[model samples]
Target: MNEAIERSNPEFPPKIINGCVWKLREKSPGMVNKPSRGVFQLLKYRN
Candidate 1:
């Protein structure tokens, strides 16, 4: 995850994924995940 973020934006710091909240270094970027159903929902929402 960190690698991917870094690839896109090297300035992006490491982020910790805990449920819906995501912590990036010293900053909290708010909710990173959303409620979903099964594989169809997952495929429907691809970032």
Candidate 2:
């Protein structure tokens, strides 16, 4: 994820990946093991 973000814009680094889910269950769809960062979050970027 960091690699992709870096490739997108090296100079402009407003976007960042805070947390991620390691795995998920097959029974539950669209559901992660636990809460993840950057999800359902909206914040203003500072200069």
Candidate 3:
């Protein structure tokens, strides 16, 4: 079975989306503070 399966990318590992979401929600607190939302928004929080 291992031989039949193509090798996965070495750079990135598998992750649980729900766990990641929970962590982000807990850490950041504010909904609009996420980095991917925008650089401008992140700067907005700084001041």
Candidate 4:
């Protein structure tokens, strides 16, 4: 994950995911596991 992010944007900090609210799920593969609360969330990034 860090490698991909760095490849795309070298200036991107490694700490970006540190304080972020994220989850890992076995069924969803490489997706963020949190549920969307409303319509606005549907357009948000999933993986």
Candidate 5:
């Protein structure tokens, strides 16, 4: 999921930080700032 977004937008963060991943949504006309969205996941990484 993260990989797909990253592939589409290089600016996307690779992994969640502090249990959350922040992203900017597309801006519309008359919008003062871009909306931000967060994806939280308790991911277990295996090495």
Candidate 6:
């Protein structure tokens, strides 16, 4: 789990360095901040 996530997005692991392996990419907020209407409600809160 650790190795897979690290290679996909190298900058990811450090953001949640203290977190566990179960945390999904979508569950990790702030990683992506693209504004939209359907999914990614957090985008509206950004900027």
The candidate maximizing TM-score is 4
All candidates: TM-score: 0.28, 0.26, 0.27, 0.33, 0.28, 0.31
The per-residue C-alpha lDDT of model 5 at residue 29 equals: 26
Q: What is the lDDT of residue 10 in candidate 3?
A: 37
lDDT for each residue of candidate 3 in 11-42, tens digit (9 for 90 to 100): 43334433444366356666434455322133
Which ten-residue region of model 5 has the weakest summed lDDT? 38-47
lDDT computed for candidate 3: 0.40
Instruction: State the C-alpha lDDT per candidate.
Output: 0.38, 0.38, 0.40, 0.43, 0.40, 0.51
Candidate 1: the clashing residue pairs are: none
State in Å the error of residue 41, model 6: 28
Reference-based lDDT, residue 10, model 2: 81
What CA root-mean-square deviation does each model show from the true structure?
A: 8.3, 11.6, 10.4, 10.0, 13.0, 8.6
Taking all chains together, the TM-score of candidate 6 against the true structure is 0.31
lDDT of 1 by residue, 1-47 (tens): 43555677766444532322233322432423334421112224457
Compared with the true structure, what per-residue lDDT tens digits does model 5 show for residues 1-47? Answer: 45566678787556652223333223222332323244323223211
Local lDDT at 34 for model 6: 32
Q: Candidate 6: deviation at residue 8, Å?
A: 0.4
The TM-score of candidate 4 is 0.33
Which regions in candidate 5 have their CA more than 4 angstroms from the true location? Answer: 16-47
Model 3 deviation from native, Cα RMSD in Å: 10.4
lDDT of 1: 0.38
Q: Model 4, 1-47: lDDT tens per residue?
A: 44555688778676774223232333344543435431112223744
Query: Residue 46 deviation, candidate 6, in Å?
Result: 38
Model 2 error, position 24 (Å): 17
Clashing residue pairs, candidate 3?
none
Clashing pairs in 6: none
